[model samples]
Target: MTASRPHELVEDPEYFRDVLNSMRMIADKNLRRVRFGLTGDGIAPHYEITVPDGDYMEHSVRFPINGLTHHTHHQSPEPFEVTNLTEKFSWDDVIGMLERALSRKRERK
Candidate 1:
């Protein structure tokens, strides 16, 4: 898991929605499915973009609940890697990270 010094309290509903919206835009452009929702009494939120590789294979870029860091999880034969953001980041940063991870996966195909 990746760890970073929390910069903002994204637990707020409005902020969370905005973040998800921004991520959805990226997912739409990249042909990925965005899955996100609030968890744990509506305090923590989690978002993920899953990119399908084939009929039965896929990979995901996830921002886990309560964690500001981003990580990539691939299917068998690939390993998970976490990236820690040490500075304040916006939704663009997250989207860029996801795009980069997806690009790398494509190269491996």
Candidate 2:
């Protein structure tokens, strides 16, 4: 049998733009007080969704790209939780996680 060729991965700017657009659509549909954009350097990017609880308290879900992995951080008064989603990541996964964290913050308020 002939050996199969390795799949090629292309880093097209259009593809990146499409991905960002999809995330923006998700944020527009479901999230409030959202702030999202590529970092100035274009080497690392991040998006944050915040739910303000009070003057001093807030719940935040942050997605930051580190190397080749996508890392998530949930910040709150209880404790900081970090998750790496590079293995099996999807837009739905990110959205769901944010929703859960926001819900918990709302419940506590």
Candidate 3:
């Protein structure tokens, strides 16, 4: 038998677009008046969403797509909550987590 090769992952822009669109649909269904966009390219793309707090101040969070699902505030390493999607996460899980994050009302001090 011939030596087996490791499976290489290819960067598919179309697939990425589809994922982005799906995320947008979820956001539209759950959240209101939020702006969504993409940040970065290739394999390290992130989903950026700007949500308005109680004071109407826009707060943006970036969610990386490569590993465990988590959202960061202003590029901080401290994520709101870490959920390992590699275990048993699904699109429903994503919607729940994202809705929680987006719906959180930030206090204005």
Candidate 4:
């Protein structure tokens, strides 16, 4: 089963649409789906947000998703492991990355 978030982010009982609106906006801007961050607790995942491990690690990868798959990806210091990047653009994966990035950005702020 997928992990559950801590507190409810949208306190309003009817803010579900609003949340989706925010997510859609982020997706349009990022060229990928972006969702809210869930910081790590004893239960939350992504304790190693910067490092790739298990099903989350990938360096240079060819995405199977058409339209975006043809684009070339830039290299990074992310351990340079070869793996399929289709996960990066997946709805769930994009949201996970977005969540982790959001938490990290808040730490800097």
Candidate 5:
């Protein structure tokens, strides 16, 4: 089963719409369906991005959300393996990661 989020976030219609729209905007054809949630600790925002690794193989990566809405970028890092997900961007880095995923998607197709 998928993990649940805080009640406040789940109950807010406007926030829900915004998050849905953002996820739709970032969806890539090459990757599996994108899933998002807070980290297991339930403090940091996390995204489960299933990206293609190679021929007939794919991997799900947990990427930390960093932005004005999520200010955990400068905080102490999580103890997980996120070496590939850590990159600097003027805004949220997820957009760039998704863009890369899209590019790969296009190239593969």
Candidate 6:
């Protein structure tokens, strides 16, 4: 490759190693595996990724610890409601989730 690009564009192998180390630390602190993946539809434009629709825990977290409060006891936030994939379909709720997350109004129930 030519050197015309910025130095940051030339990522070193150490970048991945460092990212792995950071992820290890995060997993250790949170006690959970950090998962990341594509919603699929975004890549296919209008198309949706289908999976079984069922009830899922759809876990989330909240931070109660504060630096100023330091040693104070931490409290967990209220659990929010969500549904899981139970039956497979050609559609995905990712777009819907993205919409809701972005504060866009839902089209229908």
Among these predictions, the greatest TM-score belongs to: 5
Error of 6 at 47 (Å): 26
Q: Tens-digit lDDT track for model 1 on 1-109?
A: 2123222223333434444454554444444344443232223333444444554346544333222333332221232223322322445565554455456557767
lDDT of each: 0.39, 0.35, 0.33, 0.29, 0.37, 0.24
lDDT of 5: 0.37
Clashes by residue pair, model 5: none
Pairs of colliding residues, candidate 2: none
Order the candidates by lDDT, highest first — what do you get? 1, 5, 2, 3, 4, 6
TM-score, per-candidate, Cα-based: 0.29, 0.26, 0.25, 0.23, 0.32, 0.20
Q: Which candidate is the best by lDDT?
A: 1
lDDT of 4 by residue, 1-109 (tens): 2224421232222233222333343223334332222332312221111222334445422221111111112333232232211122334554444466566557767
- On residues 30-81, what C-alpha lDDT tens digit does candidate 6 reach at each position? 3322221122222211111112223322443322211122211243232111
lDDT by residue (1-109, candidate 5, tens digit) is: 2235321123223333333333443345334333445334332334333343555456433333332253233453442344333222222333444455456557766
Give the poorly placed runs of model 5, Cα more than 4 Å off.
1-9, 29-57, 66-109
Q: Which clashing pairs does model 6 show?
A: 52-85, 52-86, 52-87, 53-85, 53-86, 53-87, 54-84, 54-85, 54-86
- TM-score ranking of the models: 5, 1, 2, 3, 4, 6
Candidate 1 RMSD to the correct structure: 14.9
Residue 79 Cα positional deviation in candidate 6, in Å, after optimal superposition: 18
TM-score of 4: 0.23
Candidate 2: tens digits of C-alpha lDDT, residues 20-77:
3435533443343333332233333333334434443464444332212323433323
Q: Which ten contiguous residues of candidate 5 have the minimum total lDDT?
A: 6-15
lDDT of 5 at 19: 33
Predicted structure 4: lDDT: 0.29
